[model samples]
Target: MKKIMIFGAASAIAQETAKLFARDGENLFLVDMNIGRLEAVRDDILSRFKTKIEIYEMNALDFDKHQELFDKAIQTLGGLDAVLIAHGTLPDQIKTQEAQEMIIREFNINCVSVISLASIAANYFEKKKEGCIAVISSVAGDRGRQSNYIYGAAKGGVTTFLQGLRNRMTHSGVSVVTIKPGMVDTPMTAHLPKSPLFAKPGVVGKGIYKAMLSGKAVAYLPGYWRLIMFIIKMIPEWIFKKMKL
Candidate 1:
């Protein structure tokens, strides 16, 4: 059984993905900000799958604590075969724009911390010469739209970082998968109206699981997001700017 560590294990998408891993008989080290929710997910998963699971409480913004958490996860899991970094925040564009601190806080949580954890994991995986590092980006990262440019920028940074990391890790046999999911229905988006474009967490979670296992460099969840983003990216800047996204 593979030992996998999932950051943000309490999230709907991460919980669903963890279940898939458990179903495959993989042991998991789950870390999240809320110990209660983490434990809930652990208990729920254990109720169905006979696999070992460990949980740790950590605020993703705790930059200095990142290495400590990774160390702990490695020790608890007995050696991690893979890691999934799924922690991120969906920020309010207008609020963030109005408050500089909010913008920085959101950016740090969504981009800086992710890169920090990924860097730590990359070092360990590079030495082992075999491991998978999968992170959840968003289709929003593909381009900047007025609707949510702040969130878009942060995810874009993550996507770009993964691209560079994947390039460097390829020689070391480390697999880096960037998951860009479209609108996923979760607590994070509860205030937003639902549409056909909105996908259930389970669907996105399964896509993440498959991408990690297959070591895909980049994956667009529900797959069609690829075409959707491609078409958006192709739009001419002047005309695109005229149309509100």
Candidate 2:
């Protein structure tokens, strides 16, 4: 069985993805800020699949603890074949713009912490010479929109970092997959108005699972987001800037 570690195991999409791994009988090391939610997720997964699972409580912003957590996971799982970094926050755009503190904190949470963890994973996997590092970036990262540029910027940073990391690890037998999901229907987006563009967490979760296994350098969840983001990226700045996204 494949040994996997997920950093944001409590989130909806992460939970779904974890379940998929369990279905495959993979050993899992799940980490989240909330131990309660982590336990719930572990129990829920165990209800369906009998697989080895370990959960740890960790706030994504705890940069200093990242190495400790990773070491613990490695020790517990014996080894790791793949890792998924899924922890993030969808900060209120208006509120973030109003306060520099909010923007910095959110940015650190969404971007810096992810890069930190990925760096650790990259180093470990690079040494192993065979592993997968999959992260959940977003289609919002493709292009900045006035609606939520702060969050977009954070994810954008993640996407770019993954691109370079993927290149560096190409010959090392380490698969660095960047998963850019569109508007996913989770608690994160509950306050926003839903549209046909929105996708369910389970669908995105399944896509992430496949992407990691296939060693895709970049994957747009549900696939259509690829064309959609492509069209959006193709739009001229002059015309695009004048209209609402």
Candidate 3:
């Protein structure tokens, strides 16, 4: 059976993705900072599927803990076939402007932690010469809009970092996928204004599952956002600066 480790498994998208994988009878190692949320998901998965489900209470931002977490996962599951990076923090943009620490925290949670975790996964996969790493980035990374450019900037770093990792792993039998989800209706986006193109967590999870199976390099969740972001990315900088995105 394929064993998968999901970081930030308490997030809505992670929870939905866990359900999909559980239904397939895959062994899952669900990791999250909130023990309560992790236990709830563990119980839910146990109730629905007759498969192995391990829960890890972890803070993704702590790079020091990553090695220990990876060791424990490998010890419990034998080896990891795939890893899903879904943990992130969406800090208030206004607060970021006032506090450098807030901006740093956002970057650490959204970008640095991903890189740290990916490094561990890369080493593991490289040794085995086989594995998949799927990172959940955001459409916000495509361009820096006025409203949440700080968040967008961090996500942009993640997108670029994953792309580089993909390049590095191309010939090593390790597949790296970057998932750019646009307007996902999760707790993270609850306070944001509604969009016509908004997608549910389940929708994004299904897309990620398919992309992982297909070994897709990069995928935009909801699919249509691929074309939408393509057009947005094409807009000339002069016009882009004049209009609010």
Provide the TM-score for each candidate, comma-separated.
0.99, 0.99, 0.97
Q: What is the C-alpha lDDT of each candidate?
A: 0.95, 0.95, 0.91
Instruction: Give the true-structure RMSD of model 3.
Output: 1.0
Say which prediction, candidate 2 or candidate 3, comes out ahead on TM-score.
2
- Tens digits of per-residue lDDT for model 1 on 1-245? 99999999999999999999999999999999999998899999999999999999999999999999988988888898999999888998988889999999999999999999999999999999999999999999999999899999999999999999999999999999999999999999999999999999999999999999999999999999999999999999999999889
Tens-digit lDDT track for model 2 on 62-181? 999999999999999998999999999999898899999999999999999999999999999999999999999999899999988999999999999999999999889999999999
| Residue 83 displacement (Å), model 3 | 0.3
How far residue 204's Cα lies from its native spot in candidate 1, in Å, is 0.6
Model 2 clash count equals 0
TM-score of 1: 0.99
Please identify which of the two predictions, 1 or 3, would achieve the higher TM-score against the true structure.
1
What pairs collide in candidate 2?
none
